[model samples]
Every structure is written in C-alpha cells, then in structure tokens.
Target: MKKILILANNDVGLYKFRKELIRELVKDYKVYISLPNGNLIPELEKLGCEFIETPINRRGTNPITDVKLLWRYKKIIKSTNPDVVLTYTIKPNVYGGIVSRISKVPYISNITGLGSAVENGGILQKVTLTLYKLSLKKAHCVFFQNKENEEFLSSNISIGNKRLIPGSGVNLEQYSLLDYPKSKEIHFLFIARVMKEKGINQYLEAAEYIKKKHPNTVFNILGSCEEEYEEKLKEMNNKGIIRYHGMQKDVQKYFRTAHCTIHPTYYPEGMSNVLLESAASGRPVITTNRSGCREIVDDQENGFIVMQQDSKDLIQKIEKFISLSYESQKGMGIYGRKKVEKEFDRNIVVEAYINEIEKINKSIS
Candidate 1:
C-alpha cells in the first residue's frame, strides 16, 4: 500500500476540519500524521491515523525552535519514506515543504490562512513571504482556500500547480439543518477563540448595546479563550451581557436554539469554517466583509456583512438583523443552508484531495 504523511500544527484542528479527507485517505493509504499532541489523538487513532507526537510552538518566531522543527520534519520524512507529503498551517507548510524538496518527495501544501504576522504586514510579512517563496517552489500542488490568499501568494512568489478549494468544506450530514426557532427573543451566537482579532470586543460591545435596547435578546459566546479575555468574558457572562460556553465539542446543539450566528472576525482567514458550519446548520450569519467571511455571505440575501473591526457597523448590522421580520430572518437562514449545500459540501474537498493525490501518484509511478 502507498504511504501518505501529513504534517500540521495541531491535532484538534486537523481532526475537526480535515477528518473527512483523512478518513478517506486511510482506507486506501497508510496514513501517518505529525502534529502536537492534543486531546484528539485517541479520536484520530480510531480513524486509522498513526499519530507522531511533534512539539510545535505554533506562534513563536524563535530561530532555534524553527530549525529544530525543520530537523524533526527531515527525520520523520526520512523514516516514513512516504509517497506524497501533505502539510498545513505555517510552520509545517514551510519546514515540511523545505525538507520534502530536499528529500526529492512530491508534496502538496494547503495555505489555510496567512497568520497575523503576515496579514499585519511589515518586516514579518516580508520574512514570511520570503520563506513561503523558498519552500513552495517545488511543491507538487498548492491548495488555496480563498482567492485572496492565492492572489497574494502568487503575486509574491513563482508558484506552480495551484488549485482553489472551499475552506475545508462543512459536512452537510454532521451539521444537518435544524428547524428555525420560533422564540420571540433573538439569540445570536459567536463561535471562535476569544481573541482580539476575532472581533470578540466588538461582539461584546454589540451585545452590551443591543442587550440594553432589546433586553429580550440573547448573546451567546462559544469557543476557548486563547488570550487574556477569560476574566472579562466571565464578568460579562455573569452580568448577562453574554452567555459564555467555553470550548464546546458539539456545537450543533447550540445552533438549534440560535436564531443567527455572528462572526465579526478581522483576522486573515483562508475561509471561515464557523460561517460555513453556521450556514449549514440553517442559521444566518453576520460577519466581517473580509475574504474568508464575505464569500460566505450574500450581503442581504443569506446574511449581513459588517465592516472589519468597526463596532458601530457591527452594531448597526446586528440591529438590522433584529429589525428583520421573523419570516425574513428564517428565509435568510434557509438561503444560507441552500448556499452551503450547493457550494461548501465536504465531499467537494474530499474529492479534490483524492484527485490531486492520484495525479501525483500516477506521475511518480
């Protein structure tokens, strides 16, 4: 059987977002995954992936640590001797791509998102773009989740054999459509890390302002607090400004009661999985007018697109949603569901990977 080695920064994201592709690959290939050890290892093992516990400082810029990671990828690639290497996230994509090229192995890379370092621009963006250009020069194929990311990278680097895919498309079956709620109290959900770039402060501010005027409205926050916002979240949760459900494994239950999903993120994203999942669960979304977000929303049709980091615009959009007639609100959700079903189905991503890997395998054979 052919061997496939996958490298990523974290296990939870790999399992949560790309499990469909991994599951399909394991059936026909000997699949190995290298990522930082996390709670989801047992779950991935159940899906027939051999997990290689790799220590990765996902956001750090230490040269020694990065060199160590490169050495580790070299070791893993040499030992595994896989037919094709697959890499995701920043560190793995760069370090792993470099090692794969040196070892004369065909590899595919997924530009999931440009991290804050690159998106913010400055010396860091130049450094990162230089690294990307160096590592991705010899890649067998490059998969970009959003056109903006693709265009940015292409303009900066000489790339080959690139393909665009929906950001790790949502599973239609797992997030099946729920019945639109009939409650008079509007429920809005924010599902993402409680970080500054994710527009948490904006969400909180909007919640505070809207909750005061529409006292019956409910604001819900889900996902882990990766930064220093835990105390703030707790304080707001206690005050009834928002209900914080920290890091949920099953989000569909929350979607059941949510009238709409609000993801006011300004972070550079390849695609916003939260928006796709929310749309798949038959809920309308209100998100920023950025690349990852704007594509998921049809302006006034399926959902509203707020200006990035503009609390006033986010607040205005939230109020507009509040003012929507019940029928119109539900219709927006219906439209979102149809849109995801047509465009963001997980099967599309799975098939893309299969075809790409097949092409690589046949060419090498």
Candidate 2:
C-alpha cells in the first residue's frame, strides 16, 4: 500500500473539506494527516487514519516562528517519506511544497484563496508570491478554486499542471430545501466571520438604511465575531438594525427559514461555502461582484450581485428583494437549489479529487 501525507492549517481542511477523500484514500493507502489541533481530532481519529499534531498559526506574521515551522515541517516530510503530499491553504502549500521537493516526494497543492496577503498588497504579498512561485515550481499539479486565482498563477508562476475545482463542494442531500414558510415579513441573512473584509460593516450599514423605510423586514447575521468588530456589531444589534447570531454550528437551520443570504464581501475568497450551502438549502444569494462569490450567483436570476463595499447598492438590492412578491422570492430560491444540484454538489468535488489522485498515482507508478 502507498502512503499519502495531507497537510493543512485548520481542522476543517483536514476533517470537513477532505473527509470523503481521506476515507477513500485510506481504503487503499496509509493516509496520514498533519494539522493544528482543533475540535475535529476525535472525528478524524474515528475514521481510522493517523493524525499528527503541528503548530500552525493561521493568522499574524512572525518571521522567527515561521522559519521554525518550515524547518519542523521539513523534518516531518523526511520522516514520513510518503508517496505523495497533498496540501492546502497559503502557508501549508508554500512551506509543505518546499519540504516535499527537498524530500523528492510528489505533491499537489490547492490555492484556496488569495487571502489578505494579495488583497492587502504589501510586503506580505510580495513575500508570499515569491514563496509560492518557488515552492510550486516542482508540484505534480496545482488546483485553484476560482478563475481569477488560476489566471494569476498561470501568468505569474511557472507551475505546469493546473486544474480548477468548485469551492469545497456543499453536501446537497444535507442542505435540501424545506417548504417556504409563509410570513408577512421578509428576513435577510448574512453568514460569515465578523470581519471588516467580509463586508460585515457594509451589511450593517445597508440594514440600517433599509430598516428605516421597511421597518417590518428582519436583518440577521450569523458567525463568529472578531474582537475588533464585536463592539460595533453589538451596538448595531442593540439598535435593532441587525440581529447577530454569533458562531453558529448549524447555519442550515437559519438558511431553511431565511429569505436570502447576503455576502457583500470585499475580501478575496476561494468559493464561499456559505453561499454554496445557502443556495443548496433553497435560498437565493446577494453577494459582491468578485471572483469566487460571483461564480455562485447569477445577477437578477437566482440572486443579485452588487458592487463590492457599496452599502448603497446593497441596500438597493435588499429593497429589490423585499419589493418582490413572496412567490417570486420562492421561485428564486428554487432556481438557486437547481444551480447547486447542477454545479456545487459535494459528490462532484469528491470525484474530482479522486480523479486527480488516480492520475498522479498512475504517472508516478
């Protein structure tokens, strides 16, 4: 049996997004995963795969610790001597790719998103891009979640084999649509981490504007709050502009009941799981005119796509949805569900990974 090593920064990357792939790989190979410890350790262990703990900071910039992490990962690669190394996220893809190259191990990487590095465009962006170009030079294949990222790499980086997959696919069966509830009021939902980059403040501003005219409409937000924005969001919640449901485990419950999901993110995203999940749950989406977010929504079809960071445009779109008849909104939701079935099903994504792994395996053999 072959040995495969998976590296990621977060538990979701190891446990949720790659669960089916890991299970399938373990059937024919010795599959080992390395990630920072999180809530999913028990679940991952239950799947009969080996887990290794590693220190990975998903945020912040520290030169000394980062150098130490790179060396530690290289040592692990030398010890594991796996047939292939699969990695995701920025730090893992860059550092892990370098380690795999040095160990003469075939490897693949997924560029989940450009992240704040490229979005902010400072010293970090330059440093990360340089690292990516160097590390990915010898990769077996590089997968991107959106066209923008793919185009950026092909044009800038020297990577040869490249592919695109939909953002980590949503489980369609689990996100099935419920019957549209009859209510005299309309509910708008914003589901994401409480970050300024995610357009949380823009959503709040739009909600405030809309509520003054459409007093009966309900605006709700569901996600964890970062310390920077918690106070501001809480103040808006107190004023009844938006109801904050912080860090929910079961967002599907809210999706089943909400009229539409609003994601006016200014940040670069891979493919937004929230938008895909919302659409799968039979709800329309209103997102920004950006790469990953725009792919899931068709303007004026299933949902609307407003200019990024434009609170006024967001408010207008909200009013447009509110003005529509209940039946029309339901129709939009139905269309969104159909879109998910056709394009963003979890099984489709899993199959893509299977195919990629098999292709790489054959080449190496």
Candidate 3:
C-alpha cells in the first residue's frame, strides 16, 4: 500500500479543515499524521491512521528553535519514509516542505493562512518569504485557498505547481441549513481567533454601538483566544456588550442563531473558515474587503462587505441589515447557502486532492 505523511501545526486545524480530505485519502493510502498533540488526536486515530505527537511552537519565532524544527521534521520523515508527504499551515508547509525535498520525496502543501509574521511585512516577512522560496521550490504541488494568496506568494517566490481551492471548502452535508433561532430579537455573530488582526476590537466596538441603538438586538462572539486577549473578550462578555463563548467546538449553533456573520479582519489570510462556515450554515456574512474575507461575500447579494479595520463602517453595515425586514434578511442567508453549495462544497476539495495524488503517483510510476 502507498504511504502518505501528513504534517501540520495543530490537530484542531487538521480536524477542522482537512478531516474530510483525510477520510477520503485514508482508504487508499497508509496515512501517518504528525502534529502537536491536542483534543483531535483521538478522533484522528479512530479514523485508522497512525498519529505522532510532534511538539510545535505554532506562534513562536526564535530562529534557533525554528531551525531545530526543520531538523526534527527531517528526522521524522526519514524514519517514516513516506512515498508522498502532505502538509498544511505555515510551519509545516515551510519546514516539512524543506524536509521532503531533502529526502527526495514528493510533497503537497496547503497554504492555510499567512500568519502575522508574514502579513505584517517587516524583517519577519523577509525571512519567512525566503524560507518559503527555498522550501516550495521542489514541492510536487502547492495548494492555495485563495487567488489573492496564491498571487502574493507567487510574486514573492516561484511555485511551479499551484492550485486554488475555496478556503478548504465546507462540507454542505455536515453543516446543513438550520432553522433560525426563535428569538424575536436580531442576533449577529463574530467567529474567529480573538486577536487584534481578526478585528476583535472592531467587532466589540460595533457590537457596543449597534446594541446601544438597537437594544433588542444581541451580538455573539466565538472561537479560540490568546490569554492576553481572552481576558479582554471575557470582560466584554461580562459587561454584556457581546456574549463571548471562547473556543467553541460546534459553531453551527451560533450560525443557526445569527441573522448575519461579521468578520472585519485586517490580517492576510489564505481564506476565512469562519466566513465559509457561516455561509454554509445558511447565514449571510459581513466581512472586510480584504482578500480572503471578501471571497465569501457578494456585497448586498449574500451579505455586505465592511471596510477593514473600520468600526464605523462595521456599525453602519450592521445597522443596514437591521433596517431590512426579517424576510429579506432570510433571503440573503438563503442566497449565501446556495453560493457555498455551488462554489465551496467539500467534495470539490476532496476530488482535487485525489486528482493531485493520482497525478503524482502516475509521474513516479
């Protein structure tokens, strides 16, 4: 049986975005998973794959430690000796890409997001881009979640085999269209990492302003958080500006309840999973005009696109939605669900991976 090595930064990410793909691949290949240990390990192992606990500092930037990570990846891949290696996220795409190349193994990479280090564009971006250029040079294929991301990386580095998919593509079946909450009050949802880059402050500011004008409405926040930001989000939740549910496993409940999804992100993203999931759950999205964020929205068709980092615009957009009748708002959500079904179905992503793997296999043969 053909063997495949899957390397990533976190098990949660692999579970969230790549689980469908992993399930489809495992039937035909010997799947070996390498990632930092987390809650998803048991589920992953249950799917008949070997899981290796590889400690990774996902947000760290020490040069010495990063170099050591590459060494560790080399060791792991050397011992595993998989026919083809597939990796996702920043560290694995870069570090694992390099290791696979050194081992003379074909590898595929999914650029999930451009972290703050590269998105901020300073010395960090320079060093990171250099690493990307070196690592992806020999990759079998480089998959990007958005065109904007693909164009940005291509401009910085020469990636030969590149394919674009819509933000990992949501599973339409898994996230079925759900009935709206029975509450008479309107609800808006903000789901993303609780970080400044994701416009957490803007979300809070808009929530405060909108809630003041429209006392009957409510705003909800969800997703994981850093300690520094978690306290602030919790404080806001306590104050009743926005109800923050930190690190939710199932987000469809929030989506089913929301009249609209708000994602005013300023960070460079491969694509926003929150936007995709929101749309898949049959809810409209209001996000920034930023690259990855805008792909899910059609600006007044499915949802509105607010100005990035502009709290006032975010407030205005939320107010405009409030002005619309419930029926009209529901139509917007219906349109969003249709759009995701046509363009962001998980089957498309699954087939793409299968095709890519087959292409590589034939080439090797």
Candidate 4:
C-alpha cells in the first residue's frame, strides 16, 4: 500500500478542515498524522489511522523552539519513510516541505492563507516569503484556497506546479437551510477568531452605530477571543452593543437562526469556511471585498461586500439590510443556498484533492 503522512500545526487543523480528505485517503493507503495533541486523536484513531504526537507551536515564532521542531519533524520523516506527504498552514508547508525534500519523499502543500507575517508586512514577511518561494519551488503540487493567493505565487514565487481549490469545502447536505425565523428583532452574526485582523473592532463599532438608530436590532459575535485582544473585546462585550458567545463548536445552529452573517476582515484570508458555511446554511453574508472573503459573496445577490476596514461602509450595508422587506431578505438567503449548492459542495473539493494526489503519484513514479 502507498504510505501517506499528513502534517499540521494543531489537531483542530487536522480534524476540522482535513477530516474528510483523511477519511477518503485511509481506504487505500497507510496514513499517518502529525499534529499537536488535542481532542481529535481518539476520533482519528477510530478511523483506522495511526497518529504520532508531534509538538508543533501554533502561535508566535521562537527561533530556538522552531529549530527544535524542525529537527523533531526531520527525525519523524526519516523514520516513517512515507511515499507521499501532505502539509498545510505556513509553518508546516514551509518547514515540512524542506524536511520532505531532504528525505526524498514526494510532498504536496496547501497554503490556506497569508497570515500575520505577510499581512503585517515587515522583516518577518520578507523572510517568510523568501522561505515560501524556496520551499514551494519544487513541490510536487501546491494548492491554494483562493485565486488571489494563486496569483501571488505565480507573480512572486517560482512555483512549478499549482492548483486552486475552494476553502475546505462545506457539506451542503449537512448545512441545509431552515425556514427564516420570524422574530420581532433582526439578528446579525459575526463568527471568527477575535483578532484585530478579523475586523472585530470594526464589527463592534458598526454594531454601536446601528443600535443607535434601530435599538431592537441585535449584533451577536460568536468566536474565541485570543490573549492579544481579549481585554478590549471583553470591554466591548460589557457594553450592550455586541453580545459575545465566545467560541462555538456548532456554528450552523446559530447560522440557521440568524438573519445574516457579517465577516468584515481586513486581514487577507484563504476562502473563509465561515462565509461558505453561513451561505450554505442559507444566511446572507456581509463581508469585505477582499479576495478570500469576496469569492463566497456576490454583492447585492446572495449578500453584500463592503470595503475592508471601512466602518462607515459596514454600517451602511447593515442599514441597507435592515431596511429591506421581509420577503427581500428571505430571497437573498435563498439565493445564497443556491450558490452553495452550485459551487462550494464538499464532494467536489474532495475529488479535486484525490485527482491531484493521483497526478503527483504518476509524475513521481
């Protein structure tokens, strides 16, 4: 049997995003997974796959610790001797690819997004981009979740093989729409990690402005607050402008009951799973015109796309939705459901991965 090894920074990255792909691959290959320990190990084991406990720091950089991680992964690769490797996230794609190259194991990488390093341009961005260009040059195949990212790689890096897949595909059947709930109040939901880059503060400010005119309108935020922005977010939550539900495991439940999903991210994203899931659940989206977020939303059709970081533009869009008739709102949501069915279905994406893997195997063989 062909041997496959998967690498990720955290267990959630393996569990939430790549679970479907893993399940499919395990049928024919001896699959091994490497990630930080988390709640997913038992479930992954249940799927008849082997797991290796690899300590990977999911957050900020430490040169000393990163070197240790590189050595550890190098050891793992040398021992496992897998025929093929798949890696995702910035650290894994760059560092893992380098290790795989040294081991002479064929590998594929998925660049989900350009995170802080590239988004917050500086020395780190320059260094990370250089590393990416180097690591990605000879990759068997490099997949991007958005065209903007693909374009960046084509223009800036010397990547030879590339593919573009939608954001970790949404299960259209699972996220089936419910009837638009009739309520005295209209609720807007924002689901994302509570980071400045996610436009959390912008959402709060827009909520405050909207509430002043339409006091009954509700603004709800469902996401985990990180240490960097916790204090400020808590203060905002204390005010009646936004209702905080922390991180939610089942966001589809919330999406079903809400009128619209707001994702005003200024930071570049790979196609956002939140936006796709929300649209799949039949909720219209209000997000930025930026690359990853914009792909899922068609302005004035299924949802609206406002300019990034423009609180005034966000507030205007909110008001526009608020003023729409009940039938018009429902129509927007119906359009979204249709969009999801036609475009972001999970099966389509899984098959795409399978095809890519097969192509890689043929080429290398």
Q: Which candidate achieves the best lDDT against the true structure?
A: 1
What lDDT does the true structure give each of the candidates? Answer: 0.93, 0.86, 0.87, 0.85
Ordered from best to worst TM-score, the candidate numbers read 1, 2, 3, 4
> Stretches of candidate 4 above 4 Å error?
227-239
**Index of the highest-TM-score prediction:** 1
- 1-365: candidate 1 lDDT, tens digit per residue: 99999999998889998899998999999999999999999999999999998999998999999999999999999999999999999999999999999999999999999888888899999999999988899999999999999999999999989999998999999999889999978999999988999999899999999999999899999998975998898899999999999999889989999999999998888999999999998899999989988999999998899898899999999899999999999999999999999999989998989999999978988
Any runs in candidate 2 off by more than 4 Å, and if so which?
A: none
Model 2 clash pairs are 223-247
* Each model's backbone clash number: 0, 1, 0, 0
Tens digits of lDDT, candidate 2, 163-256: 8888888877777886775787788999888888999878988888888999988899998888998888879889888888888888878876
Candidate ranking under lDDT, highest first, comes to 1, 3, 2, 4
The regions of model 1 sitting more than 4 angstroms off are none
Full-model lDDT, candidate 2: 0.86
The C-alpha TM-scores of every prediction are 0.98, 0.97, 0.96, 0.95
| TM-score of model 3 (CA atoms) | 0.96
What are the candidates' C-alpha RMSDs?
1.0, 1.3, 1.5, 1.6
